[model samples]
Target: MMLIPTEKRLDADTPPEKRGQMRDGVRLLTYWSDSGRIVHGGFFQLAHQLEAGDVLVFNNSRTIPAELKTVDGIRVRLSREVEDGTWDGLILGESSKKLEFMHGLKALVTGPGTEPPLVRLVFSCSSSRLLRELYRQGDVIRYEHVARSWPLQDYQTVYASIPGSVEMPSAGRAFTWRMLAHLQKHGIRLAFVTLHAGLSYYGDDKWPNPALHPEAFSIEDEQAAIINDAKANGGRVIAVGTTVVRALETASDGNTIIPQAGVTSLYLSRTSKLTAVDGLLTGFHEQEASHIDLLQTFAGEEGVKAIYKEAVAKRYLWHEFGDMNLLMRQERS
Candidate 1:
């Protein structure tokens, strides 16, 4: 059941649409024994795992059109789609090229910049409407790889709502409409909050520079009220992804969860105290990403390592189109 297979395992036994689905296929984590030995189960049992009155908070932040471009035809991957027209382009060519990027601000992509060279564009106007159009027309956002452009629906998570993220907050992608309906039918109400995920490029590899992230997000009032009400009613507040956790945790006052509407540069580390979420639904992030470190706060180091090892052993796919992990509430038995 290892998830870190070099090959894709989401489609091992499933059909085209059935792959990576909650009911059809998903890697589930549960306590298998009284000794607290958590084990992997099928995702179909997830609904059964939750009680009726639970509130599932979904990060409905929709993804945007993000890509990289270059002038010299060298590799420069776009990780952070910074704004309406700019991207934090990674120069695979060299570190010096990235520092020299400010020099070529006028060089624009003429005919849809291809990848490898990572030709970044600074649109003169709002092209976010084009991304909305692509979704409406059911066209995948085209990103150049080397010579050919690649279209991707993989950036759209199943629970995607308000569009903004450069990449999909894929932890909740496995939840199907049927699963959501089932949760609702059982009185498990749901609401969405927006926390548009910024560029995941810098990762933990580079030094800390919070200012380097040109993007942050805001949550609406109604969404906040719903979450607070759920928590007040003794109902479990479940976050769909790490992005949701960051959004809610950022808005919290350590005593009361407020209806916050502002930009959050708050980076939750292993030592950060979590206040809002009772349960977390997330995918297996890469070891290099700081997400694993954030998860250590959710479950201690032992718990984090246990689930991670299970994911690696379960063969779940990594990245956006991958299987997910569910961390339930732990109580002293």
Candidate 2:
């Protein structure tokens, strides 16, 4: 895996608050795994690249204001919700004293979390109220790469409805309602699944552990039926993001998708067989990130490196507020 060049990184770049107007402003890089062909175009041209009957699976889980600034100057990013009003969160800015939050919320540091900056937080309120006050007091988490603070609405997709994910399912953020209508006019079908994305790649420099963190997801019967019919009819099932791939693959029974609603700890790698997805549309990820491994499972390692190198040379951006990549096979699997 190669590191993203400093200049090509999407440093401080964020799309405008209005998304539908910028459909033509975003960039897209498409790769055909079977034929080794690459096509670059504007994001608005996405509908023209695919034929009718393609099923694009999207993650509908919305982003939550998971970042809370404690009165003690601690920055707490709530990652995963747990039982008994507890949450797995990351605490930045060290404070030897117990932290106090807004809306009468108190944070009792239970223990170390799964990774660095992560810590277990036991809130003073009940489970339900704890969740409600989170929205009342917290702001959307920000990264060092971003220049300024943005609202939670800026992190949401047009189709986002369910509120659960700590972070945005950002690959789907490039989509607009108008673009979706265009896709529908071209006979491209859409399906929605819910995968509450957990902790994101912060400053961690190491590859993600194979033991994935549990993330909640839900696939309705209609969604499963749509995906199954698409596969059975020789239509491609294109996952809108890696989260959808994880949820769909986790709910797959052999080659067929099953309606399921639960938490998943599935990790896709070179060794894993992808039975549910035939194509992937996702944001440009760091080369050393775990997502590149999933990309290797879809495309080959060498091919991924080549395309990434091309993207870097062409000045395509990396990270959440970045360009998009569409990896599809020329032939059906």
Candidate 3:
């Protein structure tokens, strides 16, 4: 496992809003795979680094309030709703056969999930009532790195509309409406897909295997066409986050993307071959987090190691609310 040394690990304890900066005011680190070149700048300078015809594919999955507490104060984070109406969740503390919450609502632990610390929850209330309660009572799920709780709006991206993700597709968080408009005006193409991001970590330093935790995603016909056309015209398809990369790659048949909506348990790594995405824009991840493995698929193990080394040296923050990394392969001639 690739690990960031303890002394080099940096955390972003606060969001930009609390720091009195605009959403787009964070730092950006751009790396070119082909030339081994790196550039440092503010996120506001993003448009200047891209050329016309390059397509930026963003995940429009909005963040949902997924963290809830049982009557005894045990934390439960909803991962996703399965076809049978039961929800898969991660139990932060020890759990019993049933979990009780406010309003006399209770959920029975149906069985073990596909992974550790995950359990299938069947609530006593109806799906609609459970959803209502979740929205009314649940807080946005955050880790130890985040110092305090923030509103759900703070976790959502500016363009987010479809609400399903347990956590925010945070790589897109730095983008403001004005910046998106500027990209369009500068002739960069934009496309959107929906990938309800699942939990990245299970409690107690445990993590779910990306290949086992399925995330639902949708790529509409129009968006597929836009990406295909961009590639045909010699433009790069840049995924805004690792979630976007998984969704696009899941729908890809060779170099062509097929419009579809489904669940993907795709795990990308250095050995994985990417057929649809040429670039990635994402946040700095933890040392052993699966995201680091995904990054290796884009820049290789050595390349990603170099990028992380540089990022640490530059004192870049890590986590959902931290700095950004934009990795792109040299454009095909």
Candidate 4:
């Protein structure tokens, strides 16, 4: 759906910087797919909407400090891990300028990756050394919406432990220890899957070509068993973000999920039938984002347009540190 020019945008269009307290003050917009019913409330009430037996699958992959400023003044953001000594990186500020690295490290721009803006950078060091140097010098990637640099803690979830993703699994960012305790205390089971998210925003017109974009994902046997058990028992399996949906659906064998680890090229659209995810908890996406298409899969085209319109009208904050929307499937028992 096209965005109305008069409508307000996210931190990009509005004043740059996060508003209010972290996680505690986030708004939750719930949409019931069966009836097209919408409910608005604070995220603190998430437990009230989900049943006790429901399983909320989260992407536990943590955000890496991927944004780096080279000595030559070129800005580099590593998008994906190509091999032990290579990465798919995006270069900004200078295209023709040569990159300079320390400790005998060297990066050569091979060619474009999945997106036009992304270029492959073959490095000289091993993965371990590259990661150490990255953590030492790089900061979290930011967009035009954020006016200043925020720490990595601001981009991580309360339960994030695996460090790999180039960007935050933003939907889970709204969950804090307090909120997690509440959900656990109320008997809502929480499970985790890992999808090391790559650079999502490339300052390009659309997302990376779905057929060409391959993201690494891992779903453990234990997590898969929990999800399958939940479904067998008539409990809903709600994915915390589009990443989780991608991971789960990619690993699914018929209606049962197989514990596996690999690169997933699966892309969800309005016509794709979801076999694993029954509901979704995700941040409000920009109008042009391909993520809207995934949202359109759960909530119909009209339903998504309505929900997005309400979110904009409500003046909900947008982006990584923005409000969340929960789309619940009507088929849930």
Best by lDDT: 3
User: Sorted by lDDT, highest first, which candidate order results?
Assistant: 3, 4, 2, 1
Candidate that beats the other on TM-score, 3 or 4, i.e. the better one: 3
Q: Write the per-residue lDDT of candidate 3 for residues 10-121, one digit (tens) a residue.
A: 8887888788889999999998888788899999898877889989999998888988899999988999878544789888878788899988878899897767778888
**Per-residue C-alpha lDDT of model 2 across residues 274-333, encoded as one tens digit per residue:** 888888998886565567888987778876877787787787866677788999866443
By summed lDDT, the worst window of 10 consecutive residues in model 2 runs over 16-25
Better of 1 and 3 by TM-score: 3
lDDT of every predicted structure (CA atoms): 0.59, 0.81, 0.88, 0.83
Residue 183 of model 3, lDDT score = 93
lDDT of model 2 at position 192: 97
Return whichever of 3 and 4 wins on lDDT. 3
The TM-score between candidate 2 and the true structure equals 0.93
RMSD of each: 6.5, 2.3, 1.5, 2.3
Candidates 1 and 3 compared: the better one by lDDT is 3
Off by over 4 Å in 2: 7-12, 16-24, 115-117, 202-210, 331-333
Task: Score every model by TM-score.
Answer: 0.74, 0.93, 0.96, 0.94
* Residue lDDT tens for model 4, 193-244: 9999998877855557665778999999899999999888988899999899
